[model samples]
Target: MKDIYLLSGFLGSGKTSLLSHLIEQLKAEGLKPAVIMNELGKLPFDSKSVDEDVPIKEMLEGCICCTGAEKMEAQLQMLLEGEEFDVLLIETTGAAHPVEAMDAVLSPYFASRLNMKGIITVADCKRWIDRDKMTPQTRMLFMEQIKHAHLIVANKVDLLSDNEIALVTLQIQGLNNHAPIIQTSNAKLPLKMITNLEATYSSQEIQQAAIGKQLSLSSRLHTFTEPVNKDEFEKWVKELPDTIYRMKGYVPLKGHKNPFLFQYAYGMVQWLPEYIKMNPQIVIIGDQVESIAIIGSAQND
Candidate 1:
């Protein structure tokens, strides 16, 4: 059976960064690795970060654990039929609950061919502490992501002091006592830590655990054909409606040759200069985004 690993975490917890690093390491070891990416909106941004050599099946417009499961299964079957891979990595949306995702993966159709390796949840040290201040629904979704993890990674540790890190560790451990915790900045970790994981929960137990709760997020995909002025775009993104919790995409600046990768969680924005060529588009997730005005006169698909 092929090993299927799930990299789950909150938005801006660095799941995509960790996934990219792991994929590269897997390639170096001569292992064939395929990726199944889940995003909350139609336009996929995480897929662009991965290397072209690895095969990817992107589940967009919904989370794999809930509304997107049917499409995800079909994609997995297609990938299995098209190529042979030593392992499969599924990077779920930040909104996905680990137990619910586990239930979907452990379903009968995929159970025979795929092995439920483990769930590695990435947690941001600073963000973990701020969970209490978030909305009730957001807090529940965040808690569910950590509650059933096989491994808990307190990522972005560099931002916190030793004392802060210790407290965050205690908090995460309090919620998940069985899993081992690792500290890292930028989601950097040794490859062996991922490949050597043991399953903490069985499929039967996971199904029993998944009572089937849904996220209350509304998502939209925005596309822009023309290059935009960087400054204006940044301001627009940062000042988005309070309801928008997450936004990510590739944007081509008006005067720049290369495109910029933008990630926004809450009101904070992270920009990275990327070399890959791609169309300018963004996927945004929020509570009610139908009335929000996105920059560049973009169309929400």
Candidate 2:
């Protein structure tokens, strides 16, 4: 049974950067670590930032708190018993609630074996404190990440002022009295602190989730199907605005001879080559996507 560290934070909060640093440092101390990455969108961008040697598993297209988490126990149990690693580091989606995520990991199968070491929430000190007061999307993402972490990391400190930094720290700490907050430029911290920090996510959100376990795992499976005249298919995706969160799949597009592949995360779009090389396939993950529109005549079977 290994100790699992749940690394969660808002988008661009530096969780990846911090985890990269931790991986580098841990190798020096002779610790073998594996990672479970949950992607909010279809594009697997974070994998590029990780080390080449560490084993990585990707959970695509959903928030850990909602549906994708239902698979956590089975997958983790398999990893532990199969890989026999000393440590497990979970990189949750930027929109995750630490408590909810932890609860997902602690389901009956894993609770008996693995112990949760802590919750590390990476906060964009500047964004958390000063990025537009209103949320851009319907999802209450920002608040969820901030509300339930045991360790508050003030990432992207370089973007803030000395005054802004101080105020942000005070406000976050005040909001989360139990958490030990640390300020960092890019999720940087003493490696030892991550491994040894004796903290866990304790919040009403998790308790409430536990009470509604049966209902919480409903949106577990997400599947999209669409068939467009190859030409129109291209237009459909191009017409889609950045507001959509994730979009991806081996989709047939309009006007293209071969199937054109693409994936995007928050307006960051990547169109893969028709030939399979370097993760070639079409995928895009975003907020507002119309399945019926795209899957019009395509036979999923």
Candidate 3:
């Protein structure tokens, strides 16, 4: 059985930094691991920062479940098919839902092959407390990611004083009663914590718990695709409707032969490459706007 770990959190939650740290540890311990980055932008920096120089795979242009779901399974199969590695570390986009991202991995094909080792959720401690600054859509997605983790890594604790640490710990405890919380700076902690981390998914109790009923389970997708030239994909993303919370999957470009990596989180757009597969699978996850414009609350009252 291959060990697979899912790393998820909100925007700027120190996921990349922490991932680099963990990669270092994995290499030092003589483990030849593989990395899968679920990113939003054109910048290909996550590969450079990690120490191991092991194979790094990126799931670009949207949330895992929405757009990158297809490639995710294929990428995993590619890694496991040949020489199977000791473990697989998957880092999800900041705004992506942790449970939904994990669910995409288990979609029929890879369900039996991969082991749901556990989810390690990283939170920007300060940004989390100042939740009011973010839009309702961002906040809603943020809380879902936090609550679903098997272990919540409270990152950027250095910004907080001693007393602030305790307060943050208590606050996270209030939100999630299951997962134990750990504090770290740039994910610089013991590899022991991760290697021995317990799996949170229980097959027996999960059926009784009604997982499908959670979140905006029933969502209507409205795709508005424009022929975005190579140079326009980044700038064009800012113009996407605010109602579109997440946009990703696969998309085409003017000059590029391969389909460009595309994903936008609450208006922030990221473009890049699909080294594994070059096909467009774009999906937009948002509230179905009524009529020509949005008025009052999109939320059903």
Candidate 4:
């Protein structure tokens, strides 16, 4: 039977970072890893980070728990038939509800062929501290993710003060005492710690607990025709509404030779220089995000 692990987290909570690390660790252990990456945008930006040799199936333009569930089953069927992989790692969209995601993955047709490892949830330290500021629906969703996780990764602890870290840890423990919480920077942790975990909840429990309501979040994809001024772009980001939870993709700056990978979550923004030129596009995910305008009159793709 193939081992199956689900990567769960809120927007920009470092799921992809964890996924990359897990892939490397699995490869080092001489195990083959396959990934099924779900994205809210039309393009699969995160899947590009996966190693070329690893077989990947991208579920784009929808959350795995809802519109993409059928696609996910088909992808799983295809992966099972075409690949000889030891483990299957599914990176769910930030907007996905854990129960629903599990229900979708634990299809009766193939459940016997897979060993459900567990859900590894990454919680942003800062986000947890400021979760009260989130919308009621979003806050509930965030809490649900923590409540159902078998192992919780308290990521970005370095950014928080000593006291803040303690508070966040306590709160997480209070929310779900069943799961072991590991505090780390950049979602770094040993592979054995995760791969050995057994699913906390059974497939039947997940099916019974599934919440079928659609989340209010949406995503907008903007493709840039030319490089934009970095300063101007930063200014525009500063003026953005708090409703915009996450923004990420390759962005071309006027002075830079290659586009920089941009990531934004909550109110923080980061830019990492890319050595090679990438397609210039940005995916904005949030409540009512489609109405927002992109810089330089970029058209939505």
Highest-TM-score candidate: 4
lDDT (Cα atoms) of all candidates against the true structure:
0.74, 0.61, 0.65, 0.80
After TM-score superposition, the amount by which residue 184's alpha carbon in candidate 1 deviates from its true location, in angstroms, is 0.7
As a TM-score, model 4 comes out at: 0.67
- Those runs of model 2 whose alpha carbons end farther than 4 Å from true positions after fitting are 136-140, 199-301
lDDT of 3 by residue, 1-301 (tens): 5677888887678888878777778888898778888878777566667655587777777778667878887788777786547878899888678756865665333443455566788988888778889899988888888877767899899998899889988988888876768898876757787666543223431111111122221122222233346455565556555655555555656565566667666556677776664434443334331212211112321
Question: Could you give the C-alpha RMSD of every candidate to the true structure, in order shown?
Answer: 16.4, 13.6, 12.1, 16.7
Q: Per-residue lDDT of 1-301 in model 4, one digit per residue for the tens?
A: 7888889999899999999999999999999999999999998889999999999999988899887867988999999999889999999999998767865676544654666677788999999989999999999999988987878999999999999999999999999877789999998978988866743222431111111112223334556778899999999998998877667678989989998988776688999999987777665655455557778763432
Q: Each model's number of backbone clashes?
A: 0, 27, 10, 0
Ranking by TM-score: 4, 1, 3, 2
**Segments of candidate 3 deviating more than 4 angstroms:** 200-301
Score residue 297 of candidate 4 by CA lDDT: 67
Query: TM-scores of all models?
Result: 0.66, 0.63, 0.65, 0.67
lDDT tens digits by residue: candidate 1, 176-239:
7766789999998778887666432224311111111122233344556678898898888767
- Superposed by TM-score, candidate 4 places the C-alpha of residue 9 at a distance from the truth, in angstroms, of 0.4
Candidate 1 residue spans exceeding 4 A from truth = 199-301
Model 2, range 82-113, lDDT digits (tens) per residue? 77567788999876766567656654334434
* True-vs-predicted CA distance for residue 179, candidate 2, Å: 1.0
